[model samples]
Target: MSLRLRLNLLVAALNLGFLGALTWLLIDNHRNSIQEEIEAAHRVTVQMLGSAAQTSPVFGPAPVVMVNFLQSLGRVRANDIRLYTADGVLRYSSPPSAYKAGRTAPDWFGGLMRSTVEATVIGLPGARIEIVPDASRAVLDAWDSMTAIFLLGLGFVAMLHVALLLFLRRLLRPTEADARRLVATTQELAENREVMRLIEAGIEQERKRLARELHDELGQSVTAIRLIATSISRSSEAPGVTQGAGKVNEIAAGLYDSVHRIVRELRPAVLEQPDLAAALADLGREWRIRNPDIDLSMVLEGDLGDLGEELTLAVFRCVQEALTNVLKHAGATRVRLAVAQREDRLEAIIEDDGQGEPNALAGSGHGLVGMRERVATLGGSLETGMRPEGGFRVSIVLPLAGDSQ
Candidate 1:
């Protein structure tokens, strides 16, 4: 069993044991109390008979008075009673079906009342003595009835506690299952993040290699081709030869332009400057120039100082992804970008007045997923939702400089 189950069982067992002990004690105490009441009743009955025998002699040895006394005692106390005469003969009894007036009392009942035997003795004229008791079989029967009732009550409580334990176990089982699933999910996410970081590092290394080849080997080859074309144009005098030389020159120029575009796309020149805001502004200006139909706005507020390089790169990349998504998906005529300092944190909000699709914003895709991961790396919060007016908004809040530690 699990530790929780073991502990629950241990607690339940302890509770049951305590309750069992308490039930036993209560039953024992109750039985003792009933026995004490029986003893007291027996004493009162004996005293009443003795007093009557001494006071009323007109009803001399009739046995009917003693019978009536025993019957009255039984009626008053809800237990049996009996009386005996001075000649070792039974004189009267109550609960008449089970007791008689002329028979010797049982040995077991005699033993139980041994201490009161002397108290019940009555001396007579013919050297005969009679013995009565403060208790009889009737008292023992009453005790048995009480014990049965006590046991029934204890059994009922035990069964109730058992049902309660089962109900408690069922209630907590689902929460335990959910906790186990959450632990597994967190572990898988951590492993995937490590793998993605390694792949990005490899991609960066390859890009650097291609940039070097384009600047060194490819640029030199293209320059040598241009020099040969120049020589051909200067030496050739025929119109057709000159026209062929010009076509070769135009092809070399086109190749150089293509190579330059490839290098620029592989890596941005502004990433080397180490100023995040400037780099982001330059990107926005370039996008605006490239896409003249869409109007873009930028707003910078508060102190944007004391930022470290790692955080700057992460913020820049997140903004770049957000803008790319906006241009591709948001069919908006206007876009607003805001970067500011709020308390000890930096805040960035990008909003576009486009045909809002909240489902698409939350969907797992390259741009949305990358932006979320980038912001999370800096221990920040990102909120993507639809604005009240009818636009899509991506808002981020990050800890500012000197506060990350």
Candidate 2:
């Protein structure tokens, strides 16, 4: 729900709660007033009846006159006027005796008037005038007050709510506009991310093509040149001629080595294999041979080969770049590379005990950006930071479905 709607509802709820409490208090006060009215009426009636009875000159105990007086009292007071025996048996009543035990109000209303005036049970418990608290009128009066209060409160809240809505609608327009701007920015960022992914994939494919070209064309030519150098060295026995052939042989060998290194730099042949684990092992072995003075360790915990070609390639290249950075920049001697399959994801961690400052010298051109881009294209994450202990660490995570997607 919007803030305006929530606030409006809250206001309405609070109004209802407050009005309900006020209505309850009003009803309670009305009940007390009715009780007091009944008690005062009962006291006055009992005193008047006692005095009239004491002063009456009863012409041989005139019962008919007493009945007429009681009937007149009922007519004037709108109360139950009755004459009962000393044993609590009803003897006479006004407007007939049918209404003696009848209710004068609704059951809910009568329930509110729990206390009644007993009139002192004059003579005996039976021959007494009981003034029952007929709360029918009071209940109706309370009902009217409650209705009025509720309607007034609702009207007041409604008016206030309308005014607030009008004010808030104008006030929040800027916030809505800001929200729209934020949404637009988010969409632009997503489009840019997708564009970068395509660019990275293109770059990778280009590298593969270049590696293939150098391997097939330049590689063959160099092999031919090495063969010629071999033949010349064998045919020449003179020291000068032999020395020259040996130099040519040496130069050819060095050139071949450089070509091979360039090919690997472009694309490692091991990445094309189906078994990614074996590729990683081969990668670590090659690095160890290249950096004989550095200690390298690689561990594969589970069956990660099914991670597919693209994801496997990303992982391989990431590690390759990390090792290359370590070899070139880090003056440390030990490196650790670990790849593992856990649940639905594959993770790789590379750490080396070397001074790493790729981020600081990022403008100078570094492999970390390419590594990060490659990982990001797969909808994965790449983190490169210096470890607290004293070296650089790179953490990578790629979903198994990253390649398929």
Best by TM-score: 2
Query: Which regions of candidate 2 deviate over 4 angstroms?
Result: 1-23, 47-51, 57-65, 75-81, 85-89, 93-119, 122-128, 140-194, 216-221, 292-294, 328-334, 352-366, 384-392, 402-405
Mind sharing the TM-score for model 1? 0.48
Per-candidate local distance difference test: 0.66, 0.72
Q: List the residue pairs that clash in candidate 2.
A: none
lDDT of 2 by residue, 168-213 (tens): 7778667877999989997886777778777867887899899889
Each prediction's TM-score against the native?
Answer: 0.48, 0.71
Candidate 1 local Cα displacement, residue 92, angstroms: 55
lDDT of 1 by residue, 1-405 (tens): 985677677766876787678656754565465567656765675566567555444565435554554456553342344455655566555443344334444565345433322335433332222323334444455445545765676676667667766777777567866988988887776666656555655665677679778967887788788889989989989888788888888899889877776676455554465566776687788779877888899998775544665566666667777787788888988888998867878888889999877886557677777777666655577888889999889898888743331
Lowest summed lDDT across 10 adjacent residues in model 1 is found at: 122-131
What clash pairs does model 1 have?
A: none
